[model samples]
Target: MQDLLGHLRSGQVCYSTPQGAMISGDSLELLAQLPANSVDLFVTSPPFPLLRQKAYGNEDQQRYVAWLTEFAKLAKDALKPTGSLVIDIGGAYQRGLPVRSLHQYRALLAFVDDVGYRLAEEFYWYNPSKLPSPIEWVNKRKIRAKDAVNTVWWLSKTDDPKADVGKVRVPYSKSMERLLQDPQRYYTPKDRPSQHSIGEAFGRDNGGALPSNLLSIPNSQSNDAYLRACKALGLSGHPARFPIKLPSFFIEMCTDPGDLVVDFFGGSNTTGRAAEDLRRRWLSFELDRAYAAESVVRFIGDQAPAKVLKHIEQMTNGQVLAIDDSA
Candidate 1:
């Protein structure tokens, strides 16, 4: 993994911890330099192709599928045979119309059919805190419901990619708990309309229940360390940042400790921080230098605010500082 870091130019690296490094550059260019078949998981939420443009950058909806497929081609070569490529892409409304764009679906097809990656599974991230969008249709007119779900496509190089649902299982629900307490008394094993026969093994305790494909996580980071540090430094954090739990969930399920995780569109470096906390080797690439430099705050644990600011200043000056994880 260190050799992967060596491939990056010193100027590209903003900072490094024992487990990961944050690089500032075009992800496509940086990704091309790394050794092929080296990444264990390439997970990220690239900028959405919306009707309007954002500060971070987004391809026009008309060209988004092709634009993203270019990256997918390179990413496929960089991923291990058993590795997964998970992308969280939000949907968009067509300009001046109530219709939704199909760019995300098109990208999925391109990644699988064109790029030769398999669709291991599809997941949807439901952000309960998301604001109602396309006010023309949803709010004033009251026609459409709030758009709160982002389609997450989990792709892999092979049919059997490395994954373990046990790693991300959720606690059993209230009804499930009652059934587990006294299975024979509270429930009966029988087949349902689905035609799958239920057996005594269904009453066995598996520690936790398997999670559904629909993930319900909120994106309400009003006062996290990353935002606080950015506030203190008078810097603007990445506008399109997803919740850390989003990437953390995938990292835990798809890769083990010491596995390599790379996030090419590393806005706010959420994936990098998640990988670091989970003890996986990581590298995040952000095109904007300021956003890359400010993301170091995510790794500055318990360090004095003054010293942390100094480190940010050094990164802004193009110096790569070694982070003290113990701090």
Candidate 2:
């Protein structure tokens, strides 16, 4: 366990790059070096135990929990009091049995509880193309109940967790007003006084509906992106990677600009890229040296072959940003 903050205080420095960098090492070991309550948010989808043929490496399911338990402890120390931890877990099946709905939810819930984290919310990300299960009824047997959903569990250290609802608002929808009349709706707001209208209040201006626990972000380009990286870098392995949008959304919802973010199991460094695009600092730790190198190239290459543009348009509106080329 490295005391990274101790070195920072002792004036023993290494890399000085302003942009976020990916470090090659085990996340558990690297997390020990980070300062207590230093990060604004922690987000990552650790490799689920015993999910065969997955991108993440395999480990004994029981031992995996122990490793994850330690990781959770280190992550707790890394988060600021106001910060949050959003974990995306892939469900697992019973060994050699076709137990379709056997998710690790209960075990995970218990693990987080033991680690002193409070369960805040559970999001169900419905992916229409969810992997099919063998033993249970065909997931696609129903029209609306297709094999399409993942879990995004939210956890916080304290009761008064800090979140920015305004930043996470989605585009407004006129149709949502219909729900306002429903008194039984869970999110019904008092302003419109109807369940149908409650969603309209939180919708964003981008024309998309307000974000919900069931995020519809497609797993696009990630597989191809990994294949491309493997080929271009001449590497033998292709790790399962996530898109930048997935973690970026949570970072914006949970943290402010210039805050620190950490991902111990950074497969493709999507978290780091999102932090940079959103103007936040980040530090990622990956065990695979090849993946780490590829991440650095992918992150830095975008800065090159790019032209610096400035906005000279004069508008009285509050949203127009004025850019001075010096920055």
Winner by TM-score: 1
TM agreement with the true structure for every prediction: 0.96, 0.72
Clashing residue pairs found in predicted model 1: none
lDDT of each prediction vs. the true structure? 0.89, 0.61
**Per-residue lDDT of model 1, residues 1-327, tens digit only:** 568878866338888888988899988888888788899999999999988888888889999999999889989989999999999999999999999999999999999889999999999999999999988899999999999999999999999999999999899999999999999999899998899999999999999999999999988767366776677666677778888888999999999999999999987899999999999999999998888988887878357778878888888888988876575
Residue-level lDDT of model 2, residues 96-117, one tens digit each, is 6545433457546665768888
RMSD of 2: 10.1
Cα-lDDT of candidate 1: 0.89
Window of ten residues with lowest summed lDDT in model 2:
308-317
Off by over 4 Å in 1: 9-11, 222-225
User: Which 10 successive residues of model 1 have the least lDDT summed?
Assistant: 221-230
